[model samples]
Target: MKNLIRTFALVTALLLPVAAAHATVLTETGLAESKVAASETYRLNVPTEKAVATTQVRLVIPAGVAVTRFQVMPGFTRTVETNADGLVTEVTWRGRIAPMEYARFFFQARNPEQAGTLSWKVYQTYADGSVVAWDDTDPDNTPASKTTVK
Candidate 1:
């Protein structure tokens, strides 16, 4: 019996990492519009699971999209980086974020002479340096999101 219990425990431990890799929260909403013009602002709202004094928040701007501006409200520090192509590949916000607290991130950009769904992964960093990626199909990662252009 002792040997059997030990074996089961080992198996569970081995599977734990795999489970964590799969452990992601995704807060995604359907795109409200199929067409967004070149001149407009798009918005998305995301919340933290176990709110951490946020150390940083990173947003990736995919190819074919131009980011003109990124804004964070009252209590956050932000950084924006553009790649050689002059497109924003990363936008990071640094600050404290309490668990269950939500923040809105907005950006103005123009589509790169093209039109379609523009998608990218976003990551949230906790005060402890732990990171939560808003990816995968986990509903917990799902956040309020929208697209707009005029």
Candidate 2:
């Protein structure tokens, strides 16, 4: 009985990280089924699960969505890239998210006039210089957060 219990404990410990890796790392709120062509404030929730601090976050604005403003976050510098049409296509925030901590960034944007899903592709960089692209279909890694417009 002692040996069996020890084996079970070891298995549980080994599986914890796997379970965590599959968990959602980036969560988006306030954009679900928003009205078409309507402006809304959206929030992206970022959590750092690494031992090292998170150094940077980049969000790729989906096509047809026009981002107009950003709420400045303390301790972070914000940058925006625009397309030829002068619409913001990318927004990046440079800050430090300590180990086991999280941060929320807010922005206002006009939803697409047509009804469809918008997939928000985000990339997270750690202090160690490693990056994770949240554009995958696999849940084991980070996946793109999506919202629909009606």
Candidate 3:
């Protein structure tokens, strides 16, 4: 009985972190439809469920898309890095988000002239140094956000 109890406790301890991490929800809002048009400016708002500081977010833009402007809302310091193609590759924000509080990051981009769905992958890093990858090709694996161009 002692061994069984000990084993159960050990298993629970090892899985606690994994369970807590997934409990942290990262969701985006304000963008309607999975479709967008060329040269259109879209806003993406990411909200966090837990109190966190020093949140790093990376947004991968599709080829031919250009990020014209980007900004993080007040109360937070932000730094943006772009690729040679003039697309914003990553955006990092440092600040404190109270439990259930949200941070908004805005950006303007010129979409590709061609009409197709753009898969935007987002990677998030929490204050605890835990990284959650929102990039998954499979829908069952936290698939990337998608927007289709008309």
Best-matching candidate per lDDT: 2
Instruction: Tell me the tens digit of each residue's lDDT in model 1 across 105-135.
Output: 6766665555564555667777777876665
Compared with the true structure, all predictions reach lDDT values of 0.59, 0.81, 0.60
Counting only residues 3 or more apart in sequence or on different chains, how many pairs clash (N, Cα, C under 3 Å) in candidate 2? 0
Q: For model 1, where is the 10-residue window of minimal lDDT?
A: 21-30
Model 3 TM-score?
Answer: 0.66
Full ranking by lDDT: 2, 3, 1
Residue 51, model 2: Cα distance from true site in angstroms: 0.5
Q: What are the TM-scores, per candidate, against the unseen true structure?
A: 0.63, 0.79, 0.66
Q: Per-residue CA lDDT of candidate 3, range 1-150, in tens?
A: 999999999999998654443211121344433334445555544555446643666666667667787654777777777776556766666666654655556667776767786776766677888766666645554556667566
Residues 88-123 of candidate 2 have per-residue lDDT tens digits of 999899989998788889888888889998888888
* Model 1 misplacement above 4 A: 1-31, 34-37, 137-150
Q: Least accurate stretch of 10 residues (summed lDDT) in model 2? A: 22-31
Q: Using TM-score as the measure, what is the rank order of every candidate, best first?
A: 2, 3, 1
Quote the positional error of residue 121 for candidate 2 in Å: 0.3
